[model samples]
Target: MGKKSRKNVFTPEQLLSSLMDNIPDHIYFKDAQSRFIRTNRAQARFLGLAKPEDAIGKTDHDFFAHADEALADEQNILRSGKPLVGKIERVRYGKGPIVSVSTTKAPITDSTGKAIGIVGITRDINDRMLEEERLKSAQEELENTVRTIDMELNIARNIQESMLPERLDQIDEVKVAALYIPCSTIGGDLYDVIQIDEDRIALLILDVMGHGIPAALIAAMAKVSFTKHIARGLKPRTVLREVNDELIAHLKNERFLTVFLGIVDKARKEFVFARASHPPALLLRKRRRTVVRLSGKGIFIGFAPRYKYEEERVPLESGDIILLYTDGLVECRNKGGVFYGLKRLERLLLKHRDAPVDELVKRIREAHVEFMGDVPPSDDIAVLIATLE
Candidate 1:
């Protein structure tokens, strides 16, 4: 080794000078009195100073005139006697907007390790902090919307539930089994049972030709009108007539209703059914162990200014069952987007025909699940399983 070179080993100041220039972060040294000692190129740029020399002896207050804020940070770092790391907000020297500065202030001690000064590194995290704030605001807005939707849906669900018959026990030699599942928080499909003079039982299944809150509103109105007209001893056809007029008057041109209304006479064991622009219903006869479908007639209610349907009668024998439903059952799609059509439903009905009302519901639900195979219900499903004992 050369004698002169060996004697001139690197000094602490030389090593620190090398470190300041090589570091990517904006690093600086401050005296015990909060004055700048040495700073890097990045630090100078961050402070909007043309050169490191311009910032070397200045304080944070000198660079940033936001007096109270700069003082608070200096006090915290000095009193803590430890590094204070956090986000500090400041309007950048010449930048258009306020910026978030992530800073770390470490204690630089002497030989005895007593604090002598501060060494700081800073970064501009304005973009990240702004993004976080935007996400927070969006999340809050979404939460607010969810809360409002929940409140509204809960009210609608309660109203729909109220419209349904209370005593699910049984009705006049017939046991009623029904299920209503909405694809969303609310649904457009509905059904109900009503007793007229203890002899005739009115069964109604209505699909409002659409989904969501709009359909629900129409279904609710139809329910109110049905109650009013049926109380006047109006037949199923007459009740539907009045309901159709009222719906056409209220609903928009694009909307209509497909419905099935029937009266089951306990004494006669007869079911007189009327339909309006709906799919066929299923009749499961325990005697034949077979399922039969009867298609509905006429256009959907609320379509034209006037519409009517003729009544059809079926002699309900012992163990005869009538299954009414919205087309949602057959129209339901799988993950592959293929529907579980009428044929599949008929076969499923045949397989579970003799199952009890509740069991039949379970079977139907299971079939729907298996058919859908991990897909969401494509639409609302409304089921009504009634049996003549």
Candidate 2:
């Protein structure tokens, strides 16, 4: 005898029944009027029925609060002969709690290819929908918080800029020009030129240890202290000592500041300057075509209490230029990791030695920008140029 065929182990009806009852998703068939012809165990339990047979001959209106919309969707599927796939729906069953479901409905066609009814499968998606809604709400709140912070930062930037001098006044026999750029909305670099007496003027530039809000606050405090000491007719060294004491008292060695202060006296035709761990000032002699580094020894402010600062005196002549700047100018790097060192800046000054103070400042800035190319400076930059007539 021939071996029994595997296909004969179960009839088609038995296989269909097994599949419909085993799956967890709701599966059902509806007639043209949208009344249920048959339902699986899952669908019957979903409709609060004790058995699948009890769901027969019942319409969705008997068990669903929004049955009219479901009926319209099924009727459209039966008429269009097209399948509706993966549609998310919110439904209430017999006044029970609402639920989210992903549903697919297809037209059940006859041998003639005419749609006679609709076959549908639905899966519960209530938990997934709730999670997505919660995530969306959180994202909106985060975006709102970011916007508020940005607005406040802009306001802070404006206030910091306002603290700087609008323009440096030209004292007797001296002309001045300055430029400032911050790596961010606010920075730790500051510069000021103040008239000390009829024949003397004070110039100051300072750099805090870092960038952003903390550094900027320190810079502001240093500025206020420097100005107060200068107003009392203190010498360059005395002014630095007072400012250092003030900073040490407040910061307690938590931060540091580099400062260069100069007093230009027309009567003596000399520039008296002091340093606090700052870069040396450059003096460009137009007639001799020489650049001199006015170096002095001092410790950084806020590092120690009562740190004594020393002064250096350099003679000034007609057509002489004094360049004061923060380290950010020389420390700026290019894409090749090459620094725009002091040698390059000295060469630039020599090249523009004959240019006016304002023109020279402009040229130096342009050269720095060109050297950077697409690279951005990592710190704040400030330059002050004083020319003697």
Candidate closest to the true structure, highest lDDT:
2
lDDT of 2 by residue, 1-389 (tens): 23567648889989989989999999999888888998999998899999999998999989987888888888888777889899999998875799999999999888999998889999988999999999999999999988876776676566567668888856879888998877755567889998888888898998888655677678778888998999888899999999988788788778899999998888899999999999999999889999999889899998988878998899999999999999999999999999999999999999998888899989989999999998878888999999889
What are the candidates' C-alpha RMSDs?
4.9, 3.5
Q: By how many angstroms RMSD does model 2 differ from the true structure?
A: 3.5
Worst 10 residues of 2 by lDDT: 1-10
Error of 1 at 25 (Å): 5.7
* Model 2 whole-model lDDT (C-alpha atoms): 0.88
How do all models score by TM-score?
0.76, 0.83
Could you tell me the lDDT of residue 141 within candidate 2? 93
* Candidate 1, superposed: residue stretches over 4 Å from native: 1-26, 40-50, 65-82, 86-98, 109-115, 168-177, 180-184, 197-199, 209-212, 233-238, 265-270, 328-380
Question: TM-score winner among the candidates?
Answer: 2
